[model samples]
Target: MSGIVVFGAGGRAGRAVTREARRRGHQVTAVVRDPRRHAGIEADGVRLLGGDITDPRAVALASEGQHAAVHAVSPFTGPERGFAGLDPEFFVKAAEALLRGLTETRTHRLLAVGLFANLKTPDGTPVLDDPALLPPPIRPFALAHQAGLDRLREADTPVDWLVLTPPARLERDAPRTGRYRVGGDTVPDPATARLSYADLAVAVLDETETPRHHRTRVSVYT
Candidate 1:
């Protein structure tokens, strides 16, 4: 079983990933901003790390000895999900922390949980280039997410990093058929549908173990 650390473990996707990791018998650590707030994360088998991802020392200490780590942090903040207060500094700091953790922990592989808006549009153009797709309000969020992807790529590190793009329609309540497909660069499914949070969790774990694509961006959908 792989030893894994999931950043942002208290969030929707993070919780699902942790749960599925345990079902597979992997030693899973759920790193969170506050352990007590996520009391349910505590159980017989899982290890919990309490701290903010903004802290380099904390991330390094928590990520140590893990085989692979998944970053589930959202670039979105506030009700508008706007980047009104968005600071690249936050993510830059996070990059430092994650790099340290990967180095100190000897974790050789990491997967970035990316967003769908970062995917290209129908005309085969990068979505970030199309204003209509992004609109006024959520545009900043899209840009920030895109920037994060860029940083992940440029950051110098020994660990292999893979970016996973999720469809925009991804629904938390979607039914789990345990069925899905993966496409690269752009969105895979023409249907433009959502995968169950459960199913997304499955995809993340599957990629971690099998890793068919390395140093590449992949999209998952049902």
Candidate 2:
């Protein structure tokens, strides 16, 4: 089977996608900023390589001949880390590099993990606009994520891309139920909308192996 190259392989979403891809018997190239720091991700049928997601040449080098690429790279890990040196255009730059590099390598598919903050409420207000739903301090990071999504929408590249946005309550230790529902650009019932990282991986690989959504972003939840 053709391999899948995953950027930000050390991250939670990226790691889950890598695990699910291997579980489905596909070769995986796990790209991170430092391979030595992610030795735990190395295993049978997986190759760990160091590369920068914001660099087009590095993206092409890591993604050459792969079946698809997953963009799970995030400049901001968490709120405690704060936005000390956050670049507002981080995702925009990533989108540009991925489009250029993937098109150059002839890789036709790009699956990106998206933030739920940009999703709209029932009344059509973005989740990021609601301070109760999303803290005010985190708005910058969410906006950065939104910029990347916008960049993809504005591009005319041949690379087929999809962004899967998970709910706010993504449980790290929850079991994989192997089931999920896809929704539009609105936040599902915040009370009941939650997803396991494992199940999110299932949705990601399901779309990767047999894409049902194209050039669009969708919310995935349990």
Candidate 3:
């Protein structure tokens, strides 16, 4: 079985990816800030590792011997938590660390979960730019995410990375239909754009195994 290391395994996206990876018989290293608090994620083929996504040493430790790594780390969990202590360059640090660590470990593939705010509208305007689509208060988080994506795009590394951007309406409790549509950088129609966390995981693992896209970002929705 292929080994996959997942950062942010304690979060919704990370948990979904971990479940999908195990369901497909892939060995998973679930990296969280503290393994003790995330005891529930432990399973037959999953190994829980405590590590920081922005630390190259920790990332390298978790990435060693893994075939591919998933970058699902997020700084802000919810609006209720506020953005007071949020680092604007959180993603940039993560990209730098992941690239350096993965290169050192020879882990070639990196699959990342992206924010929908970065996707452009039909008129070529980013969703994050439009206050109607994205609230002004949340823009900082979106900008941080964009910075991380930019870092990945500008990097000259051997690691092949792909960022899967999900729609705004990502339902965590929705079932896995094993169905999703891939689109380019533009955002899909709001009326028709939706995706389940489970299905997103399916797409992540599919790319992990087959790797149809490389060194770029794509929108995934149902």
Candidate 4:
């Protein structure tokens, strides 16, 4: 079994992935920006490495010798930016930094947490483009993720990557049913865009354990 490195391990999604991977008995490394604040992760018997995802050197150090890596880092959400709100470009910056680190280290395996807005409707139009489907405030964040996703697709690298897009509403602390339906490009159920973070983490870990949907985009829903 290959050891897995999970970026943003202190975040909700990152913690879920770390927990799931550890449950599977695979060697796991949880990378966070602050070690003192996230000491609880170390108590889970997983190695806790302090590193910033936006720093190439830090990311490379965390990626060293790891078989796979998961990018679950999200931007800081708040109204501190006044009406303009948070910097939407944070996703692209973080994604590029991690990509650079992975490419430099020849860590070919990567799975990134993606936005549901990137997924298409049944009619073949990206939900991100539909203002009615996506709220006004979050449009910027969605666009930022889309930009990052576009770059990933255009970049010609040895990395075997997949962006795992979750549903619109990702519930935290929900039950881990360990069952989900996989879809390509569009959501499987147009009516329901909801999934538990635990189940989504299961899907992520499953894909990590076995190579599936490589160099592609996939979505999971309960």
CA-lDDT, candidates in order: 0.77, 0.91, 0.94, 0.84
lDDT tens digits, residues 17-126, model 1? 89888989999988988788887887747898896676777877878878988888764633355466677566556666777778787888787777777887656877
Candidate 1 residue spans exceeding 4 A from truth: 75-83, 188-191
* Candidate 1 CA-lDDT value: 0.77
Task: Judging by TM-score, tell me the better candidate of 1 and 4.
Answer: 4
Candidate 3's displacement at residue 186, Å, is 0.9
Clash pairs for candidate 1: none
Kindly list the per-residue Cα lDDT of model 3 for residues 1-222, writing each as its tens digit.
Answer: 899999999999999999999999999999999999999888565899999999999999999999999998998887788887889999999999999999999999999999999999878889998998888989999999999999999999999999999988999999999999999897678435899999999999999999999999999999
Per-residue lDDT of model 2, residues 136-186, tens digit only = 999999999999999999998899999999988888899999999999898
Residue lDDT tens for model 4, 17-99: 99899899878889988889999998878999999887888888998888899999876532254326556667667777778
Ranking by lDDT: 3, 2, 4, 1
> Which structure among the candidates has the greatest lDDT?
3
Error of 1 at 189 (Å): 5.6
